[model samples]
Target: MTKPQIVWLRRDLRIEDQAALRAAAEAGPVIPVFVLDDETPGERRLGSASRWWLHGSLQELGDALNARGSRLILRRGSAAQVVSLLADEVGAGAIHTIRHYEPWWVKAEQDIAKRVDLVLHDGNYLLPPGCVVTGAGTPYRIFTPFYRAAMAHMPPPAPTSAPHFHAPARWPASDRLDDWKLRPTRPDWATGFVEVWTPGEAGATERLKDFLDVAAEYETTRNLPSQEGSSRLSPHLHWGEISPATVWHALDGRQGKGSESFRSELFWRDFAQNVITQFPDYPDRSFRPEFEKFRWRDPAKDENAKADLKAWRQGRTGYPIVDAGMRQLWRTGWMHNRVRMIAASFLIKHLLIDWRSGERWFWDTLVDADYGNNATNWQWVSGSGVDAALFTRIMAPLTQSAKFDAAEYIREWVPELADLTDEDIHDPPNRPRGYPDQLIGHREARERALSGYRAMKAS
Candidate 1:
């Protein structure tokens, strides 16, 4: 009777550079498992679009495991109970997994550790959260210092290779991917997603290769939504299909501004995790306490507020750039980072809605709707988090669109204005035929936002 070890998979979906999976394989027969435990994350559960991606990603992982003479066990239930029961039933010698930072995941880890030989490894981040800190022994609240401290560490650990062996003489019971109903079928909002993405390890590596080919232009191209300047690796990174270390090692010694810019973007992901690790309640609360006093319109309580939020979500805010960004998110399950900031600013400052409202919407919509990054970025935009942008700094959507040369982006998402010239794309002469009027004039909204900021400061 062989005692098989369990390799529990989470966001770290890929087999390559997988430390825990390899460790489990080295020890004994490995039972690779992915438990969809909705009970664990609770309020921070994966959104609809994310689930859709998960469905395809799991299919790929299963195929990859099969090719390697192993199998990926799929289970749905409370991970603590399900994993523990499986271990006991199989008489497993040990369970290996990567560490995760989500608050609920941390709780599950504690509960599972008490019941099993849970061996934890760190492979989710370029540098595991809290590893880079100030000399005073505290997490760096500012990204620049954190970036400097992290860079001083130089190249990350060499990526571990995927294990080349079979796992378990007989596979355990697994759930069927299709039966889970992870993807929406009735409305099929994700129909566009297939055209834009391939959700697995192979897709991740291919995206990296594409980005590196033009890595030198990344700095300039990343800002222009029209160009394929951005890496578009957020979803893959969020799902752990590709490890940050693998991304880092790929760009190692690559001399170019684009590679350097892209590397900093990766660091920001790690920084968000660091912030969340230091402040567990970060998703719901602000890093700066005074932000609690800041007046935020409750869309749930007021019908008028609700209408504004609906318009923002549907991309009918009369602001061409904001509408374009919102529509892009609905169609593709992703948005350009520059437009994300502009749209976020419009909701927080222009609409006077609470950042949490926008955060929740993004949580439900983005394929890469990460709890840590979403919280950090929303707060950063709203001036509520550590090293946040000033609340007074309201982003003018029209100006942003013009500066980023988003005419092509607007035309792609907002077809109503596709016929307009470059000058008219960001702002039409008198509200184009089919387009809605601006929610509020840009100058008026800016003044209103400043008033709200002043009142918050005065209070």
Candidate 2:
């Protein structure tokens, strides 16, 4: 009997197109393990929304494995320590896992390698991060050139089907899924999430199939919040329930601006990973150094700033579009991409809050929250990233609301404004009875943001 090969699971939860699982199954008896190593990520541990998704996803994966004459071993501790102990218990030969680039995961991988024959494979991204590079042989910092270069390697290799698992003679003890308490119970804020999302590989496949029908119209309808124009596959992709290659190949040969645009968004995911690979601390710090000196209201020190931050989080910021987006995020664990920008801008520029504060909020709230993507987006909106918009270009939420025709979306999320006319919904000529007034006048906020930018430059 060949020694059992341990396949360590992380974000790559699905069996299909999972290189590590495939390799392990082929090698010998496979023992698949998922360690709930909260200590590894420290402050970056899975958030409440993410924890809810994980419970469902893990249950689905465990059942799938059981159906295939195997089981998903659940343990809680440091991943390196758990895997080492498990390997010893099962007399496993080698540990297999997909490569991950998060700073903490990278450190965990290195630590695990020291204790076992750890084999890593790449299947998470369309192409591995550092594989695409400039003529100078260094990674490209900008997106446009990187996208052009990466296009040459378009359509990643066909994804492999789930491999047959040869079971071991004896199984190890495992923890019950219910015992983990991953889902919220006190007040149960995630009731809406259960209605909006399905958090498994099957759910991911269904979402892709649904997106294919509208993929051709993506470019035109994507920005309109009222329309289901976006794919809504972020959480699935972030969890690696569906591989990027699977999505790319699914849309292969489809002709339309929408298909092209959607594919570009996928590439952007790859681009974000490449960024964090080069800059591990990208999440907590500004990519542009001078912006560090820029004055931002500290909620801890200022009561007014604290109150404003509280209102923003509660979706009472008074700008219908911004409030709607934040509320949508609270209810659904996700937000429309266009509105995400508007809401983020309102916080960073309008409230004069540090972008990090908003980033941390999204990190805790979003089911699809990814360290690289979250930080990159917030920094981009704050004009503090390497490839960021000018700090002077503060977004006017009212203008954006009307321009994007978000009246219907606002109505759905902000019911107080539901009775308002299409003409009055976006700006709400008079404050609705229940809705709060605008946090700050758009013009006043814009000028203040610009003045702050100028001061930063002068300093």
Candidate 3:
């Protein structure tokens, strides 16, 4: 007899090219289920933005499944409890899902496996975890070497088509998705965001097509926040509405300067996952131990510093570039990679705040907020991460903005500054009509930042 199988959905939302679902279907009748228990992270439920994206992506996945003569079975509560209950109810002999690397998930999966035959797949990554390791079986410590090694190991996995599936004998009852209340209604600020984002697997493929068709100029235009030079696939990738494998497969014939740059960015994603694999604490704590003693500023006590964070978050910072990035994040729940670096540097260095604080905000707000990327990127900017910039290097927002046409970006987000031409808007004017003065007097803060750096080194 063909034993029943449950293809449990987690981050991997798409039925197309889904290793878990394909594996289950090969066996016999398969049950496609998505459990909305954010407790996979053990008390760390999904972030607001992630939950919002999840609601939309799952709706699309369900619609796709319904078209394929199946429906996404929804469940809530603990992974082990829910999976075991469904397994018994359906007489399912096995459960399968794309493996995840977060510590909380690592633990939960182990517990779930105890009750049911869980078939795990390394489907989310391009080469899977620990595949591209160092000579001694250690993970690559840094990105450049990691990227080189990753490229050498595989060109790109062949993208798979949505598998033909078989339905379960009986459909399981599901919770009304509306009751999930993942979408906000009381304080609806996401309408603009929703209008901008095309969520789900199908949407992800369209985005990939758009990027490849026009990727030749990404090297030059990507930095300009005003131009849509990016793939904007981060949210989709985060939710597993699409996989890195799908992306690599899709880019097989692409050859251009921008293709390499784009691949390099994706390599960073693999690199970050490798970091999380070796060090589960990569999200909360610095990988390097020496800098653990580094003293972070207390925004509550530091009136000037508190003002700086407020300015950055509210898009009111006197620095046009910084304000523009912050405002972009507020309005779109996303920011350009270059602008993200500038804004992150300003918060951690210029403002002398903890990177963790910035990480928390991005976690809550960024629609593409992957735990691995958000933590790694924040650590990278703060120079507290394992493969981060040295603590001595500080980003000059003024020079960076000028270099990247920051004024152009500033005009888009900070409409108040739109009145001032780019040349006049790069720096704060002596007495601008509506704009605030340089929030902390950046020059003074630069010196203070150096002093704090010295203190940290001296400690």
Candidate 4:
């Protein structure tokens, strides 16, 4: 009898298109393990919304494995230590898992490899982070060149089917998923998440199918938050319930601006990973050193800044578009992509608060909050990333709301403005009965943001 192979699960939760699971199944009897190691990540541990999603994703994954006559071993502790002990107990041949780029996970992988025969497979992104390089063989930092080079290798490998394997001779003791307390209990904040999301492989497949119907119109409709223009697959993709390769293959042979535009967005996800690989602290630190000196209103010491931050978080910011985005994010663990930029910009520029504040808030609130994507996007909006827009290019929230036809979107999230006409919905002429006043006028906020930029330059 061959020794059992251990498949260590992480974000890549699905059985299908899972390189590690496939490799393990091919070798011999399989033992699937999911270690909820919060200690390793320390401050970067899974946020509240992510933890809630994990409960559902893990439950579905365990059921799927059980249906195949396999068991998912659950444990909590230091990942490196847990895996090593499990390897000893099961007499595992080798440990297989998809590569993760988060700084903590990268370090954890290195430590685990030192103790066991750990084999890392590349299946998370379209391509491995460092695969696409410039003419000089260095990783491309900017997106356009990277996109062009990556496109040259378009249409990623076809997704593989789920494999079958024998179960371990004697299964180890596993923890009950419910005992983990992953979901909220007292004052349950995630009531809306259940209605909006389905957290498993089946759910991911359903979402992909729905997106296909509108994929041809994606280019025109993607920016419009009012309609179901977006794929709503970010949470699924983030959890690895669906693989990018699967998504790519699904979109294959569909010719149109929508498909082309959607593919670029996928590549952008890859770009974000490439960025974090180069700068592990990208989430915490600005790429440009000058930004280190940029004077942001510190909520810690400034009472006004603190109040503004609270208003932004609670979605009470008077800007209908910004408030709608924030409220939507709070109600559902997600937000429209276009509005995400607007809300983030309002926090960083209009409120003159640190981008890190908004990033941290989203990290806790969003089910799809990914470290790489979150940091890259926040830095991009703040003009502090290697590839970023100018700080001077302040976005006018009212103008953007009207331009993108977000009246319906606003109405759905901010019910206070629901009765307003399309003409007045974007920027209510007066304070509505229940709605708060604009946090700050667009022109004043833009000027303030630009002034801060000038101050950073002079400093």
Summarize candidate 1's per-residue lDDT along 1-459 as a digit string, tens digits: 568999889999999999999888888999988999888788877899899889989999999999988888999999988989999988889999999998888888899999999999998888898888799999999989999999987688898888876567777899998899999989899988999999999999999999888888989899998888988999999999999999988887788888888898998898999998999888799788887888877887988889999999999999999999999999989999999999999999999998989999999999899988999999999999997999988888989999999999999999989999999889998777879998889899889888878887889
Please give the distance, in angstroms, between residue 307's alpha carbon in candidate 4 and its true position after superposition: 0.3
Q: Estimate each model's TM-score.
A: 0.98, 0.99, 0.96, 0.99
- Candidate 4 lDDT, tens digit per residue, 165-207? 7987889889899989999999999999998999989899999
* Per-prediction CA RMSD (Å): 1.0, 0.8, 1.6, 0.8
- Backbone clashes (count) for model 1: 0
Off by over 4 Å in 2: none
Question: Which 10-residue window of candidate 3 scores lowest in summed lDDT?
Answer: 38-47
The lDDT of each candidate is 0.90, 0.93, 0.82, 0.93
lDDT of 3: 0.82
Give the winner by lDDT: 3 or 4: 4
lDDT of 3 by residue, 61-125 (tens): 99999999888988888877898899999999799888988777788789888888888987787
lDDT of 1: 0.90
**Model 2 poorest 10 in a row by lDDT:** 386-395
Better of 1 and 2 by lDDT: 2
